[model samples]
Structures are given as C-alpha cells and as structure tokens.
Target chain A: MLVVSLIAFVMFRFVGDPVDQMVGLETTLEERAKLREQLGLNDPLPVQFWNFVSKAAQGDLGISYQFKRPVAVLLSERLPATLELSFVSALFALLAGIPMGVYTALRRESFLSKLFLTVSLIGISLPTFLIGILLIFIFSVNLQWLPSFGRGQVVDLGWWTTGFLTVSGLKALILPSITLGLFQMTLIMRLVRSEMLEVLRTDYIKFARARGLKDRAIHFGHALKNTLIPVITITGLQLGSIIAFAIITETVFQWPGMGLLFLQAVQNVDIPIMSAYLLLIAFLFVAINLIVDLLYVVVDPRIRIGGAEA
Target chain B: MSDALLSVRDLVVEFPTRKGILTAVDSVSFDIGRGEVLGVVGESGAGKSMTGSAIIGLIEPPGHIAGGSIELAGERIDNLPLEAMRKVRGKRIGMVFQDPLTSLNPLYTIAEQLIETIRTHLKLSERDARERAIGLLDEVGIPAASRRIDDYPHQFSGGMRQRVVIALALCAEPELVIADEPTTALDVSVQSQIIDVLKNMCAEHGSSVMLITHDMGVIAEAADRVAVMYAGRLAEIGPVRDVIQDARHPYTKGLMGSIPTLMHDSDRLTQIPGSMPRLTDIPPGCAFSPRCPKAFDRCFSVQPACERHEDREVACLLYDEGGRP
Candidate 1:
C-alpha cells in the first residue's frame, strides 16, 4: 500500500501542473506562485509526500484541483456508485460463471455446453471498451431502452446515496454492470469448467460414484466443492480487478463512479483524487486476498490444520 | 460356481480408438462364492482392474462392456439401466480403491463420508447413520472411532485412512466388495494390517471380495481362490493352495517362478521373457503363447480354450487331451 502511495505521489509530480489547469494564461506569475504556496506545492518533495501520507492516514485527502472540493468527500460520494456497480458485477460474474462452468464440465459433448464455450470465448476475446460500446449501441441508440449517460435518480440515505431504490437507477446499471462483468464472468467460467473437469477425474469422485452416491451429490456435493478451492482465490482477485478496472465501462456509459472521477482528476492533474484512488485500489486488493486466505480454511480441512499451526 | 454370490460370464471389455476397437478384457469369466475371497493377480494392463470396474458399472466412456453378463446374487446387473445400476452399487456391491489418500474426499469428515454412504443405501436417520458409521469405524480398528470419525481424511495416517475406507465400504454391508489393490499403496508394515482389516471385516459381514492386485504375496495371504490374468484372459484359476503349489498353465508357472521365495536357493528371481502384449498387438493364438517357453506349432496356431484338470482351470494347449503332444 505504501509502495502504491509512493507511485501515486510520484505521479502527482512530472505529469503536468495542477496550477496550469487551475488558472488561465492571463494570471500573473506572482498570483500563481501564491496559489502554489497556499497549496503547499512549494514545499520540499519529501515534505510534500510526508504531508500527503500523514494527512491521508487521518482521513484528510487535501482537495481536488478541478472541483475545489475535499478529495475524501468527492471520493465518498462517488464511492457508493462504484461500489454498487462492482458488487453487482461481481455477483453477476460468480452466479453465472460457476453454474456455466459446472455445466460445460459435466456435459462436455452437449450442444448447450459447446454454445456456452463459444460465447465465453467471445467474452474473453473482446476488450472491455468494445463490449461496453457494443452494449450502448444496442441498448441505448438502437433500441432506446436505457439512458446512455449518468447515474439516474439516486436515493440519499444520510451517510450513503444509492441507485438501487429507484427503477431508472437500477435499469441504468444493467448495461454498464454487464459490460464491466462480462470478461470476469467468462474468466471464472472457463476456470471453473477446467477445475470441475479435473476434479471429476479425481479418485475421490470415482469413489463417490462407486459408493452409489446420487448424481447430484457426486457432482455438486463432492466434485464441485473441491473445484471451488481454486475458484475462490481467482474470483477474489477478479473482484478486485473488476473494481480497479471499471474505468472503461464507466467511461463508455459516463456513469458517476470513482473510475470516472479518477479519469477527470487525471485529465486536470488533480493529485489528491489520483493518489487517493491508487491507494484505495491497493488496499482493496490486499483486503480481498486476506478474505480469500481465510475462506480456504473454511472450504478445505487440510488447510485448516496448516492455518492453525501457522 | 452354481452357489456363487456374484458370477461373471464371458465378460468382454473393449476400448474403441480411432484406429480400431481394442479388447481389454477378452471373454474373461470368474465367480466369487458367498463369503469367498477371490484374489485376482496380473501385470499392469492385464484387465484385472477393468473386470472389477465392469462389475460395478464404472467402465468409462469409449471403453465399455462389449459382451457377457454380470449377475449379483442371481440378478442380471450388467444390462440394468444407470439409475438401477446405481442402486445396486453401494447397497449390494461396494468398492475400495487403491490410493486411500485419494479415495476419500479431503473436504469431508470421515463421519460425513461414512454416514452418507450408509444413509444412501439404508433407511437410517442421520443420527443412526452416524452411530453406525462410528461402530463400523471401531470394528475396522480405528482408535477413538467416535471422536475421530469427524476428522478429515488428511488427519488420519495412510493405514488409518485405509481402515476408514474399509469401514465405509462395509458400512452398508454390501454383498460384494471389489477392493482394487486395497493395500498396494500402504507401508510394508501397514499393508498387512489393511489386508487383515479388509479380510476380517468382509469375513465378519459375509461379504464376498474380488481383491484385484498384482502382489503375489497378498493373494497367497488373503485369497481363498486365486485367478491369474494374462493379457486380459484368465490364464488359470483354482484354490489358492493348488494354484500356488501346482500351477497348471505355463503363464501361471512363470508368475509363481518370478516371486522370490525363501525356500528357493536361486540367486536371481525368474522374470518372464517379455512384457504383457498390448491390446492392439495380442497374438492370434493364446496371449501367452508368444512368450510361453512351452510354445510349439499347435500353441502358435490355435487359441487354447480353458480345460478343467482336477480342481484347476488352465488355458493351455498342453492341458488339452487331443492337442497335447
């Protein structure tokens, strides 16, 4: 996380001046110098970095250069939209991916399995931006069913504002979430399919069959649980990636998420938002991996002993 | 054979490939009498395991029972539908795999595995099934059965796991248990313990066992009767003592010779001249004929039918009344 903070801090420098974006060319040099001083941009490099880190640790992320608002408040407002989109996308990916994978694995020669494999191949092959554009083109321009831009009709609930309560907000989320989640869904599906295939061939599965276990018990109860050990780790990391990489989907739909905020901050050399976003993404990845490690203990007993000893 | 608990007649298992259909078990036949321990010994690819798989209806796709019937306690199970066959499996015919490490699901507790198997084939409640599982565990000689039943497979040592496997197989008290190399993967010291548990438990349950292994010592110790397979065909079969002491088939003699005996003064263990023939390249005559030291003109030209000589069935031209020199 500190390494990411350092990188984000370095990005704050040498990526053009926030003062250039803040003021027009007619502003006097003295006025510009005063503004830089006021923002502590005139401080030594190490001192500026120390101040950034210390203040960030205390929940103060300075202020956004373009919006003239506190960076923490800006992020918190956009945070809900991004989190909701990510949650939906992650849920969509897993719920669709796992069963699709198991189906393809169990019925390797079936027509539907082949069709799913083909569609997933397309899902994996196409870039996120292209999928997002194609979705917008079909759903917004051609069919005119959903709005093309912005979060619609958010319902504020004191600390958090959410789109889930409104019909239009939920409808607007469908395209972007699908566009964001499609790649991850295909990835998880293929992973699960291969894992299920491998698990099905294991001696335990054969023994389960020989024990006269029902087909459902053998497949889901025995084989599927074993297959999920690796799937959990992959899905956890993918969840992090989905949130971190939602920028393309956000850009295409013009959704009011942190990715869009990050984009705007990057364009205007808004150091506070840019650095804070980087640090936040890093923290999410670490936190997700920790949860995945803990989940291993729950699913597999062999890991439980090792975890206890460790 | 008339009083057999499980009988297999002219069983043919084949695997179809792009080139041609390969006959893995070519018209093999055998029987396990009630409470009998029938040890099946052979080299790798001898179809000993395939025969066991055929009985349980577990022959994988592209490989299948090409011909012959399997009867379990007088009912034709070979031609039964998959759903019917499944019911016959754990309830009437249980199986023990070679690797205890991989046989039990690592994710499940031993109690969970055993209770499920018991409940699947019986009408016991969960608590009753659990108690039965624990009882079987104790019977199989797992120390602290009641407490350790909830432990995962990985928690048990190799020998203990095999014991657990035996307990699981015997929990439902099936009529037949096809234990395929049940002791092959254990320690030398652990091997006898596992074999003893398997044999004693089956004997107690009156469950017929078709013990498949390549270990001659195991067959000598555990088998009431022994069957030797040569390239998917039964080379010879008889009472274990008769087959071990006075083998009739040339292949069976060669197999007995290869075993290092304390009584034999020979410096080197005898080895058969060639490996078992692959399914694709099996000779037109008896599969062992090409490698048989006693091979002659008739042996090369004619496939020998099994000839009954006293208590043994030998597939050799030498045993034929008219074909013999």
Candidate 2:
C-alpha cells in the first residue's frame, strides 16, 4: 500500500509539467505564469505534492486535461472493467491449471503427464503478446466473435435493467479474459505441479499414506493444503505481473479500461490523467501485496508476515 | 487361536542406486505373538525402520520390496495390492514415527486430526468421535484434554505430540502397532515418559508392537524379544534377556558391547571400531564380516546360514562350527 501511494506521487511527475500542458502549447509567458499561479503550480515541488496527495485523499484527483472531468471520477467509472478482466483471468487460471498440474505431478513419468508438462512448459515460455495475438487470430478473425475489440455498451435488454453491465459487458470481456487466463494458468500450473511433488515427498505425507488415507484425501486434504501457500504467493506476485501485461492486452482488445486510459494519457502527455493512472496502478500493486500478505496468514496460520498477525 | 498376530518371512527390500541394486533389507524375518512387543535394534542403516515401514506399507518410492511376505493375523498382507494395503495402515496396523514434530500433520488442530483418524476407519457419529477423541486425549495423559484439543500441532510440546501420535495410532485399537523410534526425538526424561505411555497402553489393549529403534536401553526396557539386524540382515533373534545378557551372534555381541555401562574402566567404552559399510559395498561373505572382530577366513569368504536353537536363531559360521564367539 505504501508502494501504491508512492506510485500515485510518481504518476503526477510522469506527464511533465501539468501547467504548461493545461494551457495551450503556444500560450504567452505572462499568461502561463498566471495560469500556473491559479493552478498552484507555482508552489515548490513538495508543496505541490502535498496538495496533490491531500486532494486525492478527498477523492479529487484534479481534472484531466483532455476529459475536463475529475480524474477520480473517470477512474472510478473505468476501474471495474480492468477488475473484471483480472477476476476472470484469476478464476480461470486456478480452474484450468490446478487440475492439470496435479495430474501431471501425480503421474510423474507417464507419457500423458510428459505431454501435459511439455505443453505447460511451452505455455509458460511463450510471451503474453504472442498469446494475445494468437488468441485474437483464432477467436476474433477466424471465428468472428463479437467484432474483434472494444468495450460494448448495452443497447437493449428488453427492460430498464443494467446497461453496459449486462451480457454486453460480458461479451466485451472474453478476449481479454482468455489472454490473461492463458498467461496466469501456465505459471500457476507449473508452480502447482512442482509444489505438489515436493509436498508429496514430505515425511508427514508418508505418514498420511501410512495412515491409509485414501489417495483422494491424501492428495486433497494433506498435499493440497501444503501446496496452496506457494500457489497463493505466486498468485499475489502474478497479479502485479498480470496488471503489467494488461497494458498490452487492453490495447489489443481495445477494452476501455485503465490500461487503455493510461495508454492515451502517456501518448498525449496529459498530466492529470497520466498521474492519476500511474498512482492508481502503483496503489493497486502495493495494496494487492498487502492483501496477499494478510491472506498468507489466513491460508497458513504459521506465518506472521510483517507482524500483522501479532 | 494359534495364529501369530504378525509374521514377516524372507522380507527383502532393494533400492536401485547409481552403482547397482542396493539391498537395504535382505531376507530379514520375524514374528510377534498376540500382545507381544518385539524390538528391532540396529545401527543407522541396519533396516530396522525399513522393516517396520514394510509391515505398515509405508515404504516410499525408489525403495521397493523386491521380494517379501508379511502376515497380519495369519493373512497374507504382502500379496494385497495398494488399496488393500491402505486399509491396514491405520485400521488394522498403526504407526508412530521417530520425530513427534514432523510425524503429525501441522495444519490441523489436535482434535481435528484425531477425529479424522477415528472417522476414517470407524463408523461413529461426529459427537461420538468427539467423545472418543476426548477420552483418547485423556488416556494419553494430556492435561486439560478437552480445552487443548482445539490447539494445533505446534501448540503441544514434543512429548505431548508423541502422546498425540500414540493416541492416534491406538485409537482404532489396531491389532499391530509399528512405532519407529517414537521417543528418540524427545528429551531423555520425556523419552521414558513416552515409552511408559506406549508400554502401558499396549499392555492394557493387548496389541502387538514392532518397536523399531537403535537405542539398546529402549529395547532392553520395553521389548519382550529382541531382533538385532546388521547391514540389512538379522544377525540374531532371541528373547530380550538372552539377546542382551548372553548374545550368541558375534554381530549382536558387537552391538551389545558398544553400549555404555558406568563403573567400568574400559578403553573408549568398547566401540564398534568401524562404521556399517554402505549398501553397495557389502562384502561377498557375511555383510557384517567387514566389521566383525571374530571374522575367520571362512566367515570372510562364504556367508553362513542361519542356525536355529531352542528359542533363538543365530546367523554366523561360529554357530555352524559349534563354538561361541
């Protein structure tokens, strides 16, 4: 979370001077000074940072130069789209990867396990960009599903119901979801297989076997619990990584998410929008880390990471 | 009613190593009577624990029982496959391991783990299982048994965890209990406490025990009969008193002589002199001939067969020669 706040600070700086960009590119010197003074840009850097932070605390991220709306309002409106994509990705990763990984590990040296392991290795090695393009080709161009890109708002739901929040939104989600899921599932599968293999080697697991725990209970009850800590840790770390790649994914799918918004902010050098986006991303990274830390405590009671539990 | 509670004959366990087939346990055999305690004593790699694990079907990967027969209550257990073998582990045969810290699964509460063991084998309601858990916890001598039941494995001290393991093992009232160095990891004082609990419980329940360990003191104290293994072979098997006081086999004598006894002025307390040779490096003759002090040319050249006496079995050429080492 501290990293998140600091990213918010750094985001403000990434767009160059806000005052110069706020006014016209050809504004006169005296006009620039007046504009700067009005916007509090004339204050020292630290003071300006203080104002930015305090205003951000009150939910005002100033105004976007291009949109002319509060940055927070813009982000708040668009934030859920990225969250939806990430959620779909994370869920699919676990559902797809865990079983295959477990099967591979348990099978050990079998031909089928080798095949699955090989595929998983290939999956992990491939870049997310390559996967995104391949997915776009297979699902979008070849199959012609939902016209290739962009967040689609709802036009008709037969009743005055949730608009842009219904099937239309879900339809907009598939391409990005597959892209994120493919990347994360590959990594998670590898981790799960390796960790399960290790857990299955433990003396306690041997004891469980000796206790005549059915293979199912031994795998799920004993081995899985021991293996989940690593997968969770990897999941937490991978969230930041997933967010990083979402920039490319959001760009590819043309989804109207924070990634796309941040892309525009970077390309246009729009100070408020860029700063707000960077800060939010940074905050998300740090904040998710904190949550994962707390979750570590939840999953495995033995850990007291950062004295949080104590 | 003449059925032996546990019988193992010609048990052979081998591991494929980089060099060759390393025989970890070679034709080692014994039996336990109903309500008897059989102690298997050996050095670090003498296959004592391997024998215990093979009986419980806990021998892991890379080490396979090349050839063996294990009988529990007159039934051929070794002929049974994995699924059938699993039924014997906790239901018919129980195990308590060396380290109390590592033996119990760490994730669950003591109550949860104990109840899991009960419900897995026994047809009992949740309330009945809970009642049984509380009773077993008290039987294992834990203070505040009802309250501490909710605590995790780490919450208990080493001795307490061993007691919990003992409680778990005997909860099903298994006909055979294989305890592998159950108290070796505890403090010296706690060791006797754990052993006392085990002895008292086994005595009360009339369950046969295959106590696999290296501690001569433990073997002398608890085992009714003792089987001394050397380098994966049983060097001697006899009643505990005979085995400890008047060991007939040279390897058994070497092991017995190696233990410390106070009030005796001796050089280095009768050390075994050399380490047990590696599995791959066993001499062609008797496996222990490399380390045996009484090795003649015959003892070093050709392996001697096991000779049977009234209530003892000695595997040495000296027995064949009609001479005692």
DockQ of each: 0.88, 0.70
Q: What is the lDDT of residue B264 in candidate 2?
A: 72
Which sections of candidate 1 miss by over 4 Å?
A24-28
- Compose the digit string of candidate 2's lDDT tens values, residues B33-81: 9999999988899999988888887777788888978888889887688
TM-score of each: 0.98, 0.94
RMSD of 2: 2.9
TM-score of chain A of each: 0.94, 0.88
> Top TM-score: which candidate number?
1
> Quick one: best lDDT, which candidate?
1
Query: CA lDDT of B124 in candidate 2?
Result: 97
lDDT of 1 by residue, B99-161 (tens): 999999999999889888998899999999998988899999998988998898988999999
Against the unseen true structure, what C-alpha lDDT does each candidate score? 0.91, 0.82
